[model samples]
Target: MRKRNVFYSLFFFLHLLQQASSDVHSISGYFLGSQGLNLPDYMERITVDDVGMYYYDSTMNAEVPCPEWLNTTEGQEHWKDINLISLDNRHRFASSLQSAILQFNLTGSSSNVNVYQGVGRCSLYPDGTLKAVLTHAFNGEDFLSFDIDTKTFIASVPQAVIYKRQREENPVFLEHLTFFYKKTCFERLKILLQHAPAVNMKKVPEVRLFKRTKAGSKVLTCHVTGFYPRDVQVEWVGAGLQSVEEEMVDVLPNGDGTYQTRRSVIRPEENPEEHKYSCVVHHSSVAGNVTKTWEEHSGLAAWIWISLICFFLAIAGTGLLFRRLCKTKDVGI
Candidate 1:
């Protein structure tokens, strides 16, 4: 039920992981805010495939769509309606925050503001099926949730039980949620996807393997960049077909039309060659998994550097001999 920063981060990470492991598209809406003017009074955001569709906050007081997210006529109308809805919700948000404060006895002066947030999201599977979830949080902790599949409310904390029971008793809000997520949300996303420019395509990501040594510690980093559709996997595979993973950051857009991400793993200090670790990537755009092997010590690269140095020295010697032949003794130092 709780979702603001940590919730969104973890949820989106799992969302992208699912995208890589399966075939599905999702749309999500977020409403987050504090109780008063000490912070953002009310904020709303929507996203598709991890790309922001629009942003709304007390500062902006408008649902400002990202550059191309509202280009289509239908999208413009949809935002206009959504903006009105958000405006009404912004007013309701104050009361909701106050209720949360009262629920937890968190009331205080204007300087000591409390926070509340909620989210609703739906994911469309490859077979055209959709699932929706709703969650609410207070002071950065989950309290209540709704499962669209079960059509029931769940209380994550004792304070949330009353609200859950109220929602379960009242059929109106539940019915509205069903319609909005199943019909309105899906239709809007489908329209937007259909209207995207023809140039948008699933692009194979460019992958690179590199290492960084710091404080006598070395680590191998797999950099995967410039990919499309927000679905890609980067992992470190070690000996005996074991998949070793550290903290792989979330996929982020490159401001172009593609996305980039990185994964890093510790480089073994002892007998590193015994592992033969490799960075492996998987994406729909790629025919198969892309594997890049890494080594702690690269003799081939050292030999290549040595060969280049020798070639350059030989060229310098030839130049020096030519200068002597031309009787030019004063070679510039």
Candidate 2:
């Protein structure tokens, strides 16, 4: 099933932003609450520069930090305050999930699940300028957003009218939210960056090429995997090639806490010797761009077959996780 999967989309978006500006730093927190699934009832996670920094669950009922994340902050008030906030957010997740289901009129059927994602994030750039965003989405599409520049709520979809109007009436609440996103979140991001060590620094990408024939049409893919700091750029180009139409799959996760992404393009009519095509990648992890050309050897068909099978299996293992990238907020009455 091809779920919209806001979690994947948001991560992809963050990756794009990071890839765009190598010097930009950001911190994001995600809270998920659900029922009738093969997962925990509620969970919270924090990411610093696309790496997991902290995690919490209702069952464990405690915030666990990555050793690298706390290596410089042990026995300090910073960790203590963040820990308390995580505990308090456990209760908020329950109410927010319930409110979301009711607000969206989710049927809660066995076969259907919709992701209602709300994001509150702040990014600090090399120029000492910061950008803040506060928005919510339903099924990877925008529903509502708070414009930091205007300090007003925007209902992007019809379903979000209720929340937009309700929040608009409460100017005090909006003021406090603006303060959190603009000031507090950035402060948190700077503190975490200051304490974070070189252990979790940028991860260089591993790239490969795979050729597959489906329905008598040839497709070439550049598979890049096992990378950190999720910003990456992939393009198809070679001698005498202007541009080749390619499709980029979502930035999927690896169990070892790294990430992978792929770009595939249908082969155009051309001779391998005369019209060679290569995949070029650009990212901060690498000093410069990395390029890999496709090789079509006589005995390569058998190897490509095996690679195609593994590709499908990998997608099967990675479930279509349709969820949100929301910031920690007081969702209380």
Candidate 3:
């Protein structure tokens, strides 16, 4: 599965490269959500720049072209003065049909908000002046006509064609770093947890297990969060503090400044009296071992009950034997 995903990503990037120099109007594609819904609402504009910037609502991310140097102090100050004064009117310039389509997507209405999770694409018109024919999956099965002047849809196309635009200069290493630093990591993480609480950072495993209540068998799930490097391991320990063997799953990176991992298994759902279990997180940097125990209720309770029962049994047996010996002695006399 890992290899397959890598292959698909490479293929998609190559396909985007080939589509760069063609002269066709419009392309159409679809996105399938987690539930396989062809949700148009989550569909934002498809951008084809090497920068691959997406515009969801009316406001465009004007910082796309800002170099990573602006990630520092002086660069930001310079950009504030230059960008606002000089380029305020046109951060998005449309010299071709593709550029026009891009600008239109960026200039959406207030009510337009969508979060897409699948695949989508568009074809552009090849005319040097301004002509793009493309298809959008969420809108309909038909290709939509893209206008260069107004940056809106005018008509639909019957077939997919090659739409080409002039290639801009490739971004330098600093540009790529800035792109990820600004676009992918932070912004995407915020989008993923759009429904979550403001303080809830989305990708941490945050594994959690409920209190064990029964006696025969029990399974607990714990949440883990903020794990980096994408590789992590989880283990369960018994009352004797011995490790138990169980199946494990591969951890996947969220790419948005967070990682997610999970561990689940069946064990003695320790009784309220003598239950004990521990969840340990294993990683290289952790000194010795990193573990959190949930014995506040189970392990301590069991130990206390066992100790009390043993004490009473010992006392009663000793008293009964002594009484029997005394009675025998008196009878003999």
Candidate 4:
């Protein structure tokens, strides 16, 4: 029984290893110098590093040859124009769509020789990602390589999920949701906006502070007036150029070539006097940059001082009127 159990375990492990190896594919190639010094090959894998990968072949180190044909003065000038020293001797082939041959032109040399040749094919993943691969024959040996530019599709493969309800045709829904009746259009609008991409509120409709509260908090709003897709963000800062807490409310656009947005932050609570606040806007149309801050000032203390001066003047005038009435009565007596 022990021997049978060990055999079954080994079989399961081998199956898993086979699946992993089958899932992997790679593209690689090496460069060789004129004197036959071979450099490192460029290599990339599909299962590892899902994002597209690239590398420059640089393994050759043999000295460049001064050919006998280019020994004259005119030949020397021609050699200067051709950067033969830094030239890539190997033809680099890129994979592509459809069954076809991969080709690259040899640079710097006048021979116009086709460096590398291969048969290639490309395919697209279900999630809109693309991959291309190629194979070539050299010196009676077969070589294979694959393109690593299908990152977006590879990353989109969904993670496996488990569901409690198995059957697709029969779904469990609350058997008629009852005791709910209200005429709220805004609720439906909110639901639609939830699935919509978040706006980069920091940008758009020129950030401006249009109003202030009695206690000394500035009201800021922005308009994203460009013809680009709507993506924006907003924030507030204090006089010291630091981020401050704020309460925000969403104001919808009127669909008349305008969008409305506003937010407010408590400023006077921190100073109660002459202090400043800034409105910052961020948006994607502006390359996801933030505003430098639209400024606002608080003058609550100044308004208090003006009210006190007016009250004192009214009291002095009342006392003067009483004195004048007494003087008039004494003169009549």
Ranking by lDDT: 1, 2, 3, 4
TM for candidate 2 is: 0.68
When summed lDDT is taken over every stretch of 10 residues in candidate 1, the lowest stretch is: 13-22
Candidates' RMSD to native: 8.2, 12.9, 18.3, 30.1
Each model's lDDT: 0.68, 0.65, 0.38, 0.32
Instruction: Please give, for residues 61-163, the per-residue lDDT of candidate 2 as tens digits.
Output: 4456446445544324556666776776666556545555677777667445545445556778899999887666655677778887677989886766776
Better of 2 and 3 by TM-score: 2
- Candidate 3: lDDT of 206? 51
The Cα RMSD of model 4 versus the native structure comes to 30.1
Candidate 2 residues lying further than 4 Å off, grouped into runs, are 1-20, 65-75, 103-116, 138-144, 147-176, 198-200, 214-217, 237-246, 249-252, 265-277, 297-333
As a whole number from 0 to 100, the lDDT of residue 168 in candidate 1 is 79
lDDT of 4: 0.32
Clashes of 4: 18
lDDT per residue as tens, model 4, 1-333: 533443443332222111111122222222221211131322111111111111224443543343453455644443342223134223222221001111211134432212222223233333544444434422112333322332111111111011111111222211110100011112222222232232111224565454444335444433324322333456666654322344445433334323455665544444434454556666544655545444333333445455565566566776765555434422210
lDDT comparing candidate 3 with the true structure: 0.38
* Weakest 10 consecutive residues of candidate 4 by summed lDDT: 174-183
- Indicate whether candidate 2 or candidate 4 has the larger lDDT: 2
Q: Which stretches of candidate 3 lie over 4 Å from their true place?
A: 1-58, 64-208, 212-217, 239-256, 269-275, 296-333
